[model samples]
Target chain A: MTLQRPVFPLLAFIAATLMAAPLQAREALASWNDGPTRQAIVDFVARVTTTGGPDYVKPEERIAVFDNDGTLWTEQPAYTQLLFALDRVKALAPQHPEWRRKQPFKAALAGDVKALAAGGAKPLMELIATTHAGGGPEDFQALAAEWLAHAENPKFRARYDRLVYQPMLELLDYLRANGFKTYIVSGGGVEFLRAFAERAYGVPPEQIIGSSIVTKFVLVDGKPALRREAKIAFIDDKEGKPVAINAHIGRRPIAAFGNSDGDLEMLQWTTAGAGPRFGLIVHHDDAAREAAYDRASPVGRLARALDEAPQHGWVVVSMKKDWKVVFPETPKP
Target chain B: MTLQRPVFPLLAFIAATLMAAPLQAREALASWNDGPTRQAIVDFVARVTTTGGPDYVKPEERIAVFDNDGTLWTEQPAYTQLLFALDRVKALAPQHPEWRRKQPFKAALAGDVKALAAGGAKPLMELIATTHAGGGPEDFQALAAEWLAHAENPKFRARYDRLVYQPMLELLDYLRANGFKTYIVSGGGVEFLRAFAERAYGVPPEQIIGSSIVTKFVLVDGKPALRREAKIAFIDDKEGKPVAINAHIGRRPIAAFGNSDGDLEMLQWTTAGAGPRFGLIVHHDDAAREAAYDRASPVGRLARALDEAPQHGWVVVSMKKDWKVVFPETPKP
Candidate 1:
């Protein structure tokens, strides 16, 4: 009679939990291979969450920042934002007659990839300026969203959204499940990233920090809007990443994920904090599953960050060795 | 047999819900007396949250920003940040013999409020710069935390944290419970507010936006730290509020709450955005329980915002009539 009540409650609890498990339970980061990289992530999270553990960090202080382009999705061939800009320029070329002869525009109009690459940063800036400026934020967001919906990756012939690495998607979910507030700190245009980041990443709009052009809050034809200006306000790359992160987040994140040299400073800032910290870089070394060019790649050069990784104790996650799959497979009709 | 199985599950669900009711259910905005202001707040929230209502706003876009000082807590006599600065100046007097004769420091050390008031913005800036700069972020956060815990409001003799208005606390909780992401957009020092706001208001550091001084990331004896500098990076007052909001949040808030002219631009910007918006100004009109001053008060002068509130259809909250209590009651010994 004394043991019956307790045993009955325990049996009921187990039965209830089992009934709920099918719809509610999930294996976090299931796409990640069972390896050292996965172990380090899981171990760090466990250490921080353990009550009274030496490395225990409070749930509220569990901040994690991520770099978008190369880290979250494929930035190979070119950044998705850059590709959108190129498409916009081509679509609007007829409106600007002088662009028929201009170097970057000329190459862009002809879809000449080599000529555009040879022109370098200056031409890239011109392309960004022409496509991005002279509009309200809403208009820019709409254009970017429209392009992203229809744009296809050349090699995979899949929508840009589908090109996201399955492993990274799992990482974001895992971090959130562990009481971490995840943020996207990217070098891409702030407006461009805001367009789809919420839908694609499950990271909210307010959690994204990125490069921006100046904007003036004004009434356009009696409607309130933020008009984008041509002036470059901030560039969130390399040293600028740390500066932007401090200016916006105002707190040093405990964990950071990145893929290029541009993320070097962000990683350093995060890892250099007093307590336990995690830093991971996705090394694109698998050509079979995804385009793999680093060290010499113009889009996202990985040389400097790769060279410094060993000294800094940063994890270099080899996509080939650490992942069983790259992008999510398409659903059959 | 099928009917019996379904009936058992339904009974279990009802029993579970009944067990949860007492713990989960509570009155929102209970501190406010039955009035038009409370009704408006409730109605706006309900309309926005209704799935197919004309005023419905998505969960991600349901952003509400609040001013810190007079809106969330008392800023009477002096801003809380200013009070801390005065205390710091007095405390550090022994270390600096020269400060004994310096205008702001001398006035601060002497506890001569009239002299400090006469010294104007210049002296205030000097006090802020002297108290804030040169230290790393962690050290400053600790110092601020220590002071807030012990500092008492002179009039009420209550700890600074306990001086927060009960109605505002209810409103913050109510908004969050209704899927709104609340942010503190204030003109106070960002670092100072970040130190105690989280504990006091249940607002996290990342959600606080404020005026800032420049800080640089550096290696202090080979350990990385963000060292504060004596440069005003941004001032989030009047014209600066919208600019700061744009730079930090990137999206126009659906609602804004403030007490003074410093919040004029923020309210205008928020209300001007297309769709159902809410703007509120807390009229500090309770002289018996709290200080009552507007239009001419040197600290948190309410002239412009008060005048503009009516034209913008902003709700002016009469604290004396609306609030059942001014601050949280002291715990019984």
Candidate 2:
């Protein structure tokens, strides 16, 4: 039953090499561009991190929180997780009659995106509550895995998982390389996001503070089950983002990123801190490459925040103008 | 299965008040003027955290790692976890006879502390391996919980769970309140420590980086089981602390706390950071209220590092001289 011991020595060697390496040589977001937006991020990080800098922030106070949907990854057409939930509802449709008659469910099952959108946030939430609620944490996690494995974006015909933005992936890696313990302070359901976040984002489930359904630990059939409770613990969107960040992370971030007004409060909270801070908003201005919908978009609307960007000193990144590529494959578009 | 919607206005109001409340002030550790030792800890935290201060460290870089045994909680006489392992050995003894005759197991069964120590680290490790290995993660967690609920410290006659140091508890709470994400980086088995850490230390299992037996995802009797892989992933003690911290936490800690030479590497790693950092070593100098053994003690010994404390700028906290109280109740010798 004893563990074989040789693995320790190998790990030890790798760790030593990593520690001994110079921090400056590490891969970082700074490698991207010399534009004001990229420079702002680099300068802010440098000012807060440098020992003698006026805006120097201590290592303990270096909390940098990120919004997941459009901030860390692409949230286009509809939130990718919502797509998963829709697929889950389809898979579980045989068991329930209520879903067939349900407005949003019926619309979703009928492949009527227009009808589903008309149902608005309330009905969308209902769809989430149906598929995401009632199961134990593990059961929900398995369901998420099952759906993610087979689910594809209808328009692009690409696996939903493959649609994550490449630049944001590099940004996460860059932030961590600079001693920032990156956290996903998102509007997505915590459990649903957590199910595959560790693999996709490298942010462990514990570090992900997001919207959550209330869950209770109960003994079901003599086994412990973390059952989805009836109440909603926290909805991490708009004002809820800052509230959830403070409650779960227990710290104000030094930097925040978002693409829409939903993340406005979080960005304000991060910038309000004493030290140097960065707030960047990714503007979807590239219609030729990626689907460009901003001010009028039903999902991830950037209207109110877009107007307030200049006054807040937030970096409004124009997707078409600033970036050399949109998706990982730029030549195709 | 859908969650019932509750009135949102009330919840939002309550959440706002909670987030907006002023910091809960507690009695300062600095007020205790037992010696410069206590002052050192306060000074270290202040210098590192204060914005615009000479040694200011940012919130993102504020990683503080603490050793569980003899640091956060008591590990006197023998490690509380080792005792749990021994009790588990006895509980499962009826099923296995080779353990009754085995070197370390025989000594453990005989209740001979001297013989158990005489068997050295290898045998002690062997005993632990035999008892802690083989079982899946959940099984081990359940076994740990059962033992913790019932096991009492032989000398104190108090449940092992009740033996935590009150001051250290306050320290953890205070640090966490000040934006530090506290993690337990211990030599104790990861799964074993995880079973009780959340309840006892308020640290979630994912934040715990420690020695571990590798486990694999497998289907056991048609149910998915994270089966114990016969490989040691990492043994988090001494030199292993920094390595494990790097691997699991992916950040070098700004502050590190420990009581023995086993934690020296972790302390070294913490202080090696560019900006502000702190390292505190607990010196067991009390013999009247609590068992005092340091340089010569086989258990939780602080020999090598304690000898060169001043040179390394390490703060050596004398238990008897610095603290007005030792254990929660001020244990009688």
Candidate 3:
């Protein structure tokens, strides 16, 4: 008996050709199953983009908001950004005695992963407040840039940037190519994501709307500076996503993508539009190639969205079944 | 003997191709008779843009600003926006009685073109104040949009937009195609230009820096509104151009283009850079085809800059000789 492995090179070549082909090529997403899931995306993009197409949205009105963590990139085990902050905290531990006594930071500093995980959302939020807040915008930017340059993913032993999903990169390019001004509306700190979003995602700083600390423009030591205040201006998560989208973007997004119950409001807001709209959920079902957990997962629980996917006419993409490859080219163990 | 007149189509096709070609295809100004003028421009841009180019400005440091009236678009005879405002004034004349006796309004209502031009800069500024300053942001935007839809150029009978110089439009596109983020640093009200600039020019509203009337974010009739206040925020012309550029854009432009002495300070600021920069002055020298005036032209005078063209490295383009065509074709006439 002879066994045949899928030809990786030929598959990649086909994928590249399909992506590079002009928009007229319907073959790009043709492999998607013929179900309500796929139809939602195809119909929304078509109606909104097509001129004189009933749901035709003008170029100025074509705003598409996206969640960064778990949606655009892999955010399992924990968010890649949070991992980077933890590494920074560990590296700076010798200078601060306060962190040594803190619950989450002490667990992180002592190399107690289980203990840190046990601390849950409250302790994680505290860690974020210590590292991401208090610093001025410039100082926060400098710190983020430094971490981005040096931080490596513990699992891959590669730079955190190398872990970005290639498929999502193609989707971002596709949306922008289709006259949609893509924005990263996320729960991540706005200043943190802004430092590298341009170079990594091709989305400029002004286009980013995320959780942010209040900042005041002031003349400090005879020079202008935007001082970071301790107060949180907004938290762009859960129901806050819809409120932030209305306040900042000033328009409802024609398309929205997410992977968790945290994104339910955003998906609802996007689909509620009078014109064409799309809502997609990425179901993490591949435990072999990448970490996969669903309703029971503590970090990125899909819960309500997962249960409601069938009734709501949303595209639920099963990662294990759909993606031919995951995380680009990682060496087989 | 037979006389040959060039067909309009053949001439137009050649001009369009020339305008669309990449800027590098154009000849360098090195061979031009104006030596110092050419050097000033080249040096400024080079220093600010080059990596180790003496003025080696970083990406964040690359801020180039421009004046709209006379500098960017044609502001001869009367400012195009003001003409729009005057037409709006006439449309709204039936509602107001005092306008019939007012000097500028009387000049506007009586169809007295000579008297309107004779009113000069002060009366023109006052006219703008009366029409533009009292209205809130939304009120002004609606007014500008309404006026632009109906206002016709008195000379051409085409819309005022049809009167824009083809060469200037090409120049704006050319500058943006380069690394420079071009900004409109004009004395005209910011909200006025911002209303149509994004569509007319590719510049976004956030990138526009101009003179502003003070506005307060207030709840009016239980709705949030930006109310106009009778106060000047920034005047962006003459000596004020450089100050506004420094204050808002925060970096000197490596390149500057203007058609009048009103842009002298802006040209100076751009040329002051230590490396390669470019300063171009459009000389309206085609009297038969278009209005040609230089030293004594009241609207777009090029006197002081014209005198110093020999000492400064500025490229004074002769519109008649340098450009094959002045304006784009307007409906057979």
Give each model a TM-score.
0.85, 0.52, 0.54
DockQ of each: 0.25, 0.02, 0.06
Segments in model 1 whose C-alpha atoms lie over 4 Å from true places: A1-26, A50-54, A90-130, A220-223, A331-333, B1-26, B50-54, B89-127, B152-158, B331-333
Q: Considering only chain B, what TM-score does candidate 3 achieve?
A: 0.78
Ranking by DockQ: 1, 3, 2
Most accurate candidate by lDDT: 1
Off by over 4 Å in 3: A1-62, A102-129, A132-159, A177-179, A194-206, A214-233, A239-251, A294-297, A304-312, A330-333, B1-174, B177-179, B182-202, B205-333
lDDT of 2 by residue, B45-95 (tens): 667666688887766567889899888777777888778767867877999
iRMS, all models: 12.6, 27.6, 23.1
Encode model 3's per-residue lDDT on A210-314: one tens digit a residue: 776555544455333345665555567876786556534445677888888878878876776565777788888888877788787776778898887676677
Candidate 2 or 1, higher TM-score: 1
Judged by DockQ cut-offs, the docking class of candidate 2 is: incorrect
Best by TM-score: 1
lDDT of 3 at B191: 76
Task: Please compute the TM-score of chain B alone for each predicted structure, in the order given.
Answer: 0.89, 0.87, 0.78
Q: Name the candidate, 1 or 2, with the larger DockQ value.
A: 1
